[model samples]
Target: MTTYNLARYPERLAVVQLGPGSEVPSWAESSSVFSITATSTETSIICASRSVPAKTRHHRPYTAFAVVPDEGSADFDIASGVTGVLVALLTPLADAGVSVFALSTFGTDWILVHESDADRAEEAWRRSGHTVAPATPA
Candidate 1:
């Protein structure tokens, strides 16, 4: 597996599940990094936990990490694509029994896990020869 640096984002996040075709909520705009995915079954939003409304159907307290790209290069999206990148990265965490929530942008890969497992996840990445950096708050 190719070793990559993982940078932690300092925010407790929530994954909200809304009915299909739901519009992206205004609250999500405040997040430094958030994603909205709509599928036939549901529309899911991953945003800062503090932004979610009280009645929202959501899961919370997730800590996030982003794959650090090589300096002067965005080649993080190699021929194999982000899926391949995530597969390589997720293996270590999975082996350690850490549940993860994953997302991707046009060229970046993200990894999220319950904050309770943050330390374990970092250790797993470190054991696999990846550098897990300290959280950088936005």
Candidate 2:
């Protein structure tokens, strides 16, 4: 198993579900670290919890983990690019019964779990032989 370096993001996030073809809300830009995914069925947004309006149909307070990889003399998990990284990452979480909301972008793959499960998420990854650490601001 390729070990992944996951950086835990500071801001708690939200996953907002909107109808298909819905315009990306400007509020989605509330955070630099967010993912907007549009599919045939719906437009799902993963953004800073504070950015989403209280009335939106959304799930909040998820803790985000970025597969930052490539620690240089460190490790490699960069890009939305990783072969089987998700399987490696998710399997343990699944075994641990942690529900995850995953997002992949040009930059990287994100794994979000309810804030209540943050510690368990970290433990799951660590126990799976991966490294989990606080994200360093870019």
Most lDDT-accurate candidate: 1
Clash tally, candidates in order: 0, 6
Instruction: Give the alpha-carbon lDDT of every model.
Output: 0.85, 0.83
* TM-score top scorer: 1
TM-score of 2: 0.85
Q: Please give the range of 10 consecutive residues that has the lowest summed lDDT in model 2.
A: 73-82
Model 2 segments more than 4 A misplaced: 71-82
- TM-scores, all models, native as reference: 0.87, 0.85
**Compared with the true structure, what per-residue lDDT tens digits does model 1 show for residues 26-112?**
887446568888999999998889878889899988999998887775556566443457777899999999999988776678899
State, as a TM-score between 0 and 1, how close model 1 is to the true structure.
0.87
Q: Residues 89-127, candidate 2: write the lDDT tens digits.
A: 899999999999887765567888999999999998999
